[model samples]
Target: MTSEPITVVLGSASPARLRVLRDAGLDPLVLVSDVDEEAIVDRLADAAPEHVVTALAQAKADAVVETIRGGDDPLFDAARTDGVVLTCDSMLLLDGRLSGKPHSPEVAIEQWHRMRGSTGHLITGHCVTRLHRGEADAATGHQSTSVRFSDVSDTLIERYVATGEPLKVAGAFTLDGLGGWLLDGIDGDPSSVIGISLPLTRRLLTDLDVDIADLWRA
Candidate 1:
């Protein structure tokens, strides 16, 4: 007899994150968290960048956990058995300041202008929640990657911003997308720069006694 596959719930709306997991072989049911990010940041305004991202990722995971256990949404109870929830939050720490999605052309343009010829650490916080037999537990961690940007001309930055890609991602750049050409190089996990660190996620899952391989789609 064959055993049932474990359900994997993703608690963020980031397409990049989703793509990362899917491309890695785990099929997850996306359950975007509705948590107020600004509120979370405001509450942890004095915290360090790592602490901020960790708290944000945990908050998002907790919110999704509530949604899954609070009701009878058929989709939420995908497996009706053991499962796991994954959540992540990313930010760019540059020149002693941390920033998430610029969200505006002007802001993105400004971010790129400052980022050109500079290096920043991309910190991605991760949380993995295990749900087994009506009980839930979580483990969390983070990864940081040093990203160096090319000293491109103003015209290039302006043109990139016009594409509107940078406005929707953290650090105003992507390692695997249109912004790839703007970078000189990186000194850490490339996946973390994209959004989630596979190595870190594996460790977090192991901490929860969940084997990543067991969660992979057949």
Candidate 2:
């Protein structure tokens, strides 16, 4: 059978997520949502970290879907042609407190200091919206991984912060970057830390009747 062309709309500006899609052989169109992340997290003050991430991911996907339906953007046309929209949010939880991207170098340094000699969980949530017959079907889910960090020295944290990678990453570190040096081990999917969990995403797409391999062929 011939493969169907499935256009993918990525509701994030993260390079790591884009790389994941590309490495999986899917060409995803990037759409950075303008939703206020802090407000969303604040509103979910009573929820678990996994729930909060899932909610934020769904919110971002819904915002993008609304924009596509209400505007003349080309992505809307893509959606009309059996495209899929994907959104994701990630956070680090240490002792039940959520840790998102650090706002400044000092914040990154402080977070690293707190994370030192501690084992934490990284949770990433994904939302998928499949547009069909002018309607959208959406699913939301989360993936978590346990990360253990060795005792990090002040000099090392300072040097890593100077690289500027920690500022934009959850937990103030990127497992694929110099931050890997700090990790003693991980207990789940590492890709979840990068923002998108491949296994979780694959299952969601399967439920929508979209074969990920078909997208790779496209």
Candidate 3:
């Protein structure tokens, strides 16, 4: 573990990502990047699911970096110097189409119907940035996991949608919540399904010269 404490900034407002970092014993500052995620995704409409998620993650991190740089707050400046920024985006790939967060309960129901009794790929893209010797050292990567869902009934889908958990999550389901009941199994990192992949995040941080052991020490 390093003697110096590193300020880890999470460039997202996701509670799940925040919890992941906290569980890993790192105190991360949350900064929600105000990027037009849907617009960015639209621009890459022809891209693969993995590429789309990766691009969105990078866009989010870049937006946060720019936002911080444009501000004159001394605290923000200090944070930029002493902290690492982490950003991530997730998407679901079913067949050849990308499934995103549902815009409404109706959409959630439809997506759930499509996902019923099917297996899909959950892809999460992560970006980590830190200031090093007058330049920013940024690294971007992604993790893909296969998830199989049990057969779901319309009654269950409607009930889940009414709970409002599906509206804000990619693929219209939360792997750690009531939605887990719909999943049969996962072939990769379960944390990725929740929103962020901790193992992948750790690797990116390590590549950026942040010590994972130090960050994980309670």
**Model-by-model lDDT, in order?**
0.91, 0.87, 0.84
- Write the residue-wise lDDT of candidate 3 on 50-69 in tens digits: 88999999999998888776
- Per-residue lDDT of model 1, residues 121-187, tens digit only: 9999999999888899999999999999999999999999999999889999999998999999999
lDDT of 3: 0.84
- Each prediction's total of clashing residue pairs, residues at least 3 apart in sequence or on different chains, is 0, 0, 0
Q: Residue 92, candidate 3: how far off, in angstroms?
A: 0.4
| Candidate 2 ranges beyond 4 A from true positions | 1-3
Kindly give the stretch of ten consecutive residues in candidate 1 with the minimal lDDT sum: 73-82
- Per-candidate TM-scores read 0.97, 0.95, 0.94
Clashing pairs in 1: none
Best by lDDT: 1
Q: After superposition, how far is residue 60 of candidate 2 from its true place, in Å?
A: 0.6
Off by over 4 Å in 1: none
Q: Quote the lDDT for 194 in model 2.
A: 75
